[model samples]
Target: MKFFTCSVIMSVFLQVCSQNPLRYWTLLPNILVVEVNGSLGQQPLSCLGSPQEGTRKDDKSQGIIWRKNGVVEEQRGNSYLVQLEESLGGGNYTCHREDGSLVNHTVVLIQEDQTERRKILVKTDQEDYLTCLAQNYNGEFHCSWTWNRNRVGKVALIQVGRISNDSDAQCSVDVSTQRWTCSSGQSNFSCSVDEHGHRISCRDEQHCPYAEEIQQIYVTLYVRTEQFLVENYSKQFYLAEIVKPDMVRISEVNTSMIEWSYPSSWSSPYSYFPLTFQISQFRRGCKGCDNPCTESKPAKTLMVHFTDVCQFKVKHKAKAVCVRAKDALCNSQWSEWSHLRLRRNNKNKHRQNDKQG
Candidate 1:
């Protein structure tokens, strides 16, 4: 009995450590991943400015070079300081030696922070409800929201209850481990917040679907800022209706052949968790066309089974292609499309053949 208890405790400890945010933060490379709000500001990213890994003292004397999206970047320092103009601060930045050898590479994926201004205008009210989404049909869902303008806060507590007047249950959070656990009736809930306090993700430990009219899960969130202002938000949802698969990533693009894989975050076992796919093709239009949206046409629709990769043979004239997937058997919602531009390689192949001869 004592041995069994020890083994169980060790398993729990390992699970908690695996989900620890501090560990994740440390693992992140010197890449400064930021969301740009069209503001000129300095991001104190020492990681980008720091001398390249394995860079010797002699190499530093030779000076370092920086490039943005393959174009040479101005300004010399351990860090790359620039105005966050949409055209300027976004894209892949690489530091190289004066000899043109690669040193370090940092990719800055800048998403538009559209909520910056609206957040300042809108005030947090008691009537405000959190928005939730289930990326896949089974297991979990994520909830995120912007706090009242000018208020920085942390999630103080989380509560769960059934929509059917069941007793309210509480979730305990381990700040160091960054895990939340709760037990409400027969369902067990686990949740985690991101490095930023805006998003929260929860999983149902006992989620099993049975034929029924409808079912709902209720979640409550309590947030507290440094000023001690406590505000709570609640939301109720049915997983089936809200299940939206994430955009499938296009992995391989070849002549008339496009291949993709399921999102890694999806629930396991492709045979059991089947997903239907949708493909769209965008052909080249008249030069200087005003709108390309009117030129898109449905390409193909298929299902992913037995294998993780989905391949489609499209027409040779196709210029661009897109693919998306959703729950195959269930009446769940479809996923946003994953897009790719096809660069025909017939000329390059013929050139290679001539060179070989």
Candidate 2:
């Protein structure tokens, strides 16, 4: 019985000594082996002391081994090699020591390639309300549409569809309420906008006439803000010599020199005004001189000579007169003729001279 008691004490002591204090753990190929030293006895330690089911803690004093199932290698060292079963998504991971102290770790999994989402469908058209096309859209993410350039029409807020997730955007003219609607089918779209103040009419996918054509129709407006008073001036008219020498005697010269004079009152203080004159000569009771002579000139005062000489016999009536002159600003009426009645007899000339006096 004494011997049995000694053996029992010895076994207890050996078990206590085999429980090592300095233990090192690491990962190796296909196995997790921990090494314990500095103890009184050398014995194999069971790694499954307490089942490390989940994440491991980082405590040097604790005798627990915890790791994920993917950790295929473990050994007695500072670090261990962990073989992952599959790629890990971006998330947080922890490494635990035997003492239950944990080290937080982050893991990122890289994909082979990246791909963008494609749009299902894209469309555009005109709108009646506001000015542009009423937009309808459907999608999961946010979408937008815009005119590529500034347009003649007014722009409004983008309209998003409730049922389909469709969004619409457009710009339109103010007067006619015409618009061009552009949308990104999935990613991008393009459209043109006019900056000029003109009406744009889109027909069958074509832009209407430009702003220049519209400006040609409407005259530019000019406004003056200054104030001033103007005085009213009365206009006056006077007889002016439109045709010089209104009367011409066919017998006075081979071609008569006709001259005229105007009233001083007819002169204007502003500038010279242009006038046109017409002269006419008439004769009666002469067979060869029955045809009248007439001439016209554009001048303020004109001197006209008659090439047709009078062939009337004495005692025949011949009349030469000054016709009227007309212009944009003024008009002068005809003057009375100085009638001459000739006689074939020299005695009749003396009588006519005496009668004229």
Among the numbered candidates, top lDDT falls to: 1
Q: Judge candidate 2 against the unseen true structure and give its global Cα lDDT, from 0 to 1.
A: 0.28
Clashes of 1: 2
- Which digits, one per residue and each the tens of the lDDT, describe model 1 over residues 107-223? 553334534343211233533457678986576888877766586767766776456555656557684636778786757888888888788788887776433425578888766
- Kindly list the per-residue Cα lDDT of model 2 for residues 154-220, writing each as its tens digit: 2221121111233332222234322333332222212222343221222112212211111101011
In each prediction, how many residue pairs overlap at the backbone (N, C-alpha, C within less than 3 A)?
A: 2, 38
Error (Å) of candidate 2 at residue 278 is 2.0
User: CA lDDT of 281 in candidate 1?
Assistant: 69
